[model samples]
Target: MRPLSTATLLCMSLIVPSLSQAEPRPANMVYLRTVDPTIEQDIRYATAHNFTGHPLDGYEAPQCLLSLDAAQALARVQASLKAQGYGLKVFDCYRPARAVADMGRFATQPGDPRKAEFYPRVDKQDFWHLGYVAKVSNHSRGNTVDLTLIGPQGLPADTWSPAASQADCAAPYGQRWHDGAVDMGTGFDCFDERAHTDSQAITATAQQNRERLTEALKKEGFVGYSKEWWHFTYAGDGAQKAVMDFPITAP
Candidate 1:
């Protein structure tokens, strides 16, 4: 057979691979090692509890960025804040497409044992009915994450606890985004309108803190999702990493 044209090859390259592999993503992708102490404290706190937690089996995976360049840049930003004693703790990075599938399947019955520990409050069957997942997710893009900040002592002083559905995004400051970190009215996974970065229903403190975090993230090349207070991205870069698969144990 004749060789494919360069344009055709490039177009084929756009096709994303499935996730849930031992090593995911291209080497050109950036990844910054976790160096911020405060970030460490925060993750330790979550690990201690089951909040927005990662199952123990997936622990060895390097918490990385799609591109190593992005990683180093983010690391520098975290380092600069070290003197103030706060740092970034990543909840997820470079998600495998297979893992995304896992989430979709789990979403269908969120209350399952694997689902229960991470989201005990959710009903399990309502995930599809909720906006939490579509056949395709931006998270598959590899720039999105589901994490929160930590206090000086570690542990989420106020983290967004999960609700069974996106409808739960409203109600109130359901979890807690206060205790030294910027307030964003709702916690990380609020899943509702009130959780919006610009929601009027939030407290003045929450709004102010949200703005502060937004500004800081912007300075470091990230942008907030607006609908979810805890969500943000480096902007203009996530589409390159989208893959389809379930995130789970791989041999």
Candidate 2:
């Protein structure tokens, strides 16, 4: 083979830097919509509707990206729920490691714009101690998700504005901000005991709804966190071991 000319080598150097700068998503990761377009996604961290009241780092878009295994399993769960006149609506999936750091910073910092609604009963500094926020999240492994169940009579989700009226996350289902999901005792990211998976403090209907969601996810190898009914981690094969930092980009 002939040695490359000076111009050819110079051009190659220029192209190499640009190519290396673009970080490609891991091959094992996939957007959940491609697996099941019917599964609704409301990626909270990509927007200001979450507890932080600001879009977190590394969330460039509101999309559900999960491990291929988890995505397929969730699709199967969705199919089962659809047959029963219910569906899965995911709030978050495949969170980047940077987002976890952002959450940690929020917990320690001095801002409470969303405190009235998301963590009214608890202090922000207590989020980590109470298990509401994790320094290292399983979601960064791409096999965990936060979601809710949507049933036939589910109300339309209200658009959240910074100026919207705030309600306690543990408020009665009808009184709290609706996310078009079935009543599961408390709203997503609620930092109260009532949000516990087996909390008996909630209404019987909410208890039943939690159980239904739990059973469905359990059947598909998802294990629910006792502290949050909406959180589940896929424990089946192909679950990612290493946490990822890939940005959640637009499709």
What lDDT would each prediction earn against the true structure?
A: 0.49, 0.92
lDDT of 1 at 83: 47
Listed in order, each prediction's TM-score against the native is 0.59, 0.91
Across 154-215, the per-residue lDDT of candidate 1 in tens digits comes to: 33444434443232223344343333343446544544567667889878866765665566
List, residue by residue over 1-251, the lDDT tens digit for candidate 2: 99999999999888775646756689999999999999998999999998999999999999999999999999999988898999999999999998999999999899798999998879999888889889899999999999999997677899888777398889999999999998889999998999999899999999988988999999999999999999999999788999888899987
User: Candidate 1: which stretches are off by over 4 Å?
Assistant: 1-25, 29-31, 34-38, 41-65, 79-86, 110-130, 150-182, 236-239, 242-251
Candidate 2 backbone collisions, by pair: none
In model 2, how large is the Cα lDDT of residue 52? Answer: 93
lDDT of 2 at 31: 94
